[model samples]
Target: MNTTPDSIRHVALSTVRLPLAVPISDAKVFTGRQKPMTEVIFLFAEITTEQGHEGLGFSYSKRAGGPAQYAHAREVAEGLIGHDPSDIAKIYTQLLWAGASVGRSGVATQALAAIDVALHDLKAKRAGLPLAKLLGSHRDSVRTYNTSGGFLNASIEEVKDNATRSLEAGIGGIKIKVGLPDTAEDLRRVAAVREHIGPDVPLMVDANQQWDRTTALRMGRALEEFDLTWIEEPLDAYDVEGHARLTRSLDTPIATGEMLASVAEHERLIDERACDIIQPDCPRVGGITQFTRLLTLADRAGLDLAPHFAMEIHLHLAATYPREPWVEHFDWLDPLFNETLETRDGRMILPERPGLGVTFSDQARAWTTDAVEFGIR
Candidate 1:
């Protein structure tokens, strides 16, 4: 399966919209009639070589811009059509400069990320190895923390039920959403979840950057008794000094960086001691090429890795992290892909199949609003 730039022939972009099982409310967005945040936008890319090999990858945004990401991916595809997928760094650099004017963080970087992931998937498949094995695996299984059960829109009873189910199904860590209007209610919910999951299991909370310096410190102190594993994004993503202050003031580890766009930003967080646990989302940080760089940074800084979302992509990358990795668990994506990630003894067992070990489900294809191609004859 030798492929060169000449052998690389076609690029395709598509989109699918999937409704959430239950509408999720975070600190910022509540999904109701006026807000109407029901469905998520999925933008996908498919790369095919002259040898007839294909790789699949996708990216997402919460409520807007499925078409924009798809358009950007299509625009990026023009620069990629004649380039070998094996030349990941070369392609990534080309894409970076291609979108330099747009500031390369939000949609531009996300588009590059989609292409990078598909290239890796294609390379791993050609080699007949899983992506983790291709990257080098530190462990066969990575520990998972369930996030689906803890959105702000869910009731306390719903949260408790979700936590119980996650534990009963063998996952050991549960993270719930905090940062509601009332800090007392937040404390109460955390305490209830902690009690329900028991004394030994790890309980974490995400404030989703909803708090200021003072509120974060107050809530961190109030919920300290519950023995949270970490408090996520208590302050705004860019507030390095505030995160550092909260990290120093609290006994529980401060975990942030899900929203950061670049390694330099993460370096600022690390050098400033902004967080104890560092989380990098692969798609958000321009895919594996950039993600691996961040992993090395976390290793040197002696920080633990807990990647943000899309466990399908993170689970493999997490296996290679220097420290024990905590991969987030969200079932919202289950319907979009064909394969199911297995969780046993609170750990995700990596799939043995080549590449990402996934393809779009029939349901996902049915939801696709559009698909277009470049370089295909």
Candidate 2:
């Protein structure tokens, strides 16, 4: 253990399982690409410096691979025990090589997401500033939208009700899942929701990458009349060329990139001008350091930003974008944190608290399935 005055002294890891209220389905599930999602698994990292300065960060997996992230992180996180706490990027590189044999993307980097995020949180907390301010922010709040209430599993009436509730709750936009096998039914749901929310509200639709080229174009054209803010993931996430074709052929904007796990992959989409809006998931892309690299490219390409989930971590990231941006709102993670995010006037406000401004709730601790620690506390 490091006895140096400013070096890292303690590192702890916990695997927590959060069970969903219901098994949620999207276009991918209906198409048999994957099963419904029943729970979200998190790999949390808490680091303490010798001076008692602390930071908390986490990464998560869905459907499968929870144990892989935990196991991988367990093997490599100890490398941080004696390093300087403020050298975040350097520390991430060290961990990368510590586990180089397993490769650098997917589960490998995803596991490192917790440590990277925690280091940022620790540094920000030490500075006593909100993460956005520490990173340099452009706005105090980002445009907000909701996707949890409008899943494909819900009925048309349920979709309308969810949209109404979300709007009444002060959210500025609504997003609903599309890409059902039955194209007409998808249109019917869009039409009903559009009518319910009215033309003034900004509405987006996600296809979850369930469409082929022909269907994506056809559906994109048909969706134009609804006045959609954008048509999301109409084709596969990897179909940059196809997305470029659709981006040109249709009036509605194309949005994708959430499924991609590395900044290198997003660079291809940005350089090719594949989509109008680029959505990235921070935890999926190896946390804030990697996410910050992506933001620079996205800002240069002038692509609109709307990160995919974990609004707690993304609100700060979105606030730093040079352009106006949006953040997805899902109550799914609310049970895991002690605090609630404020939404009003169609935006999610930045927290004044240091770091990510979140602390794990008792429910989160109760949900911990495994734990490990290194160094003296």
Candidate 3:
């Protein structure tokens, strides 16, 4: 390892599994299983420079397989040693091709996402600036919509109560899960929640890619009266043609892309005019560098930004988004991190602390199932 403080000397990967306080469900909750636990994996990466400065980053999985992602992260870290922490793009390219045989998405990109995020965190920390400031701040805080209260498993009354509580907490936007077995029941839920939240509060719904083109159109059209912000993942994630057709048919915008893996795929979505709101997840999309490319593309296309999970990471990215951004709120992650995300008047305030500005909780550390490190001794 180089003696210089800026040189990359070591990388560490740690894996932790967190169980959802409530077993959250969407339309596709049971892809095959009759029942499943709502647990997720948090894979964290810390890239340390020779001077003892460390940059933190992480990725997550709703499904099982933390070990596989951790293994891939370790493999990616091996090739990153000896490079400058500032070589994010170069290192990103190297890791991108290294996992090409496994395709550009999935576990490989999840690993690369960790590296890219940590590198950016490292860079921003070295500059001693908030990530958004380092990336060029566009807004003080981004608007946030609460999704934690609207899970499918909750009753209609529970849904209304959740919405009311969100409003009481100063959050003005709320999202709920739709695509229930009965369309009427789904409409009823939407109606009840909308009524509870009132006319001005923005409401959004997600089908979790459970519907085909026809059903998405029919249900989306019916639910339009509720004045939704957007209908997310109404069709399959890859059904660009279907999404375009639905997007054109509906007055309510169709938002998707959380399942998407690369900038190329996002380009296809944008080029096809698949949806009005582009929802990209940073860890799922190969980290901030790739996400920023999509953010720029979305901006040029006149599309809105509403990134999916991991609000801690997206809060900074969205704060600097060229357009006003809507970040989803999932309090499910509160137990996983050291810091609390400050929210006021329906918006999230970014932390001024250096880098990603948060660390794993000691309780979260106790959940670590596997840990590994790579670099010079």
The lDDT leader among the candidates is: 2
lDDT of 2 by residue, 1-377 (tens): 43455889999999999999989999999999889999999999999998898999999998688889999999998889988998899999999999899888899999999999999999899889999999999999999999999999899899899999999988999999999999999999999999999999999999999999999999988999999999999888999999999998999998899999999999999999999999999999999999999999999999999999989999999999999999999999998999999999899999999999999899999999999999989
What's the lDDT for all of these models? 0.86, 0.93, 0.86
- Count of clashing pairs, candidate 2: 0
Runs in model 1 lying further than 4 Å from the true structure: 1-6, 30-36
Best by TM-score: 2
Q: For residues 1-377, write the lDDT of model 3, one tens digit per residue.
A: 34454778888889888888877777776343335457889899888887777888998888765677788878768888888888889999898887778888778888788889999998888888989999998997889999888888888888888888877776769999987767788888888888877889999999888787788889988988988999999988999999999988989988999998788989999999999999999998889988988888999999999999899899999998888889898888898788988889988888889988888789888888888888864
Per-residue lDDT tens digits of candidate 1, residues 1-377?
Answer: 34444356998888889898777787765312225358888888889988777888777877566677778877767888777678889989998998788876777888778878888899889889999999999998999999988888899999999998998887869999988777888888888888888999999999988898999998888888888899999999999999999988999999999988777778899899889999988887777898898889889988999999889999999998868989999888999998999999999889999999999799998999988888974
RMSD of 2: 2.0
**Residue pairs clashing, model 1:** none
Q: What is the lDDT of candidate 2?
A: 0.93
lDDT of 3 at 297: 93
TM-score (all chains, Cα) for each model: 0.95, 0.98, 0.96
User: In terms of lDDT, which candidate is stronger, 1 or 2?
Assistant: 2
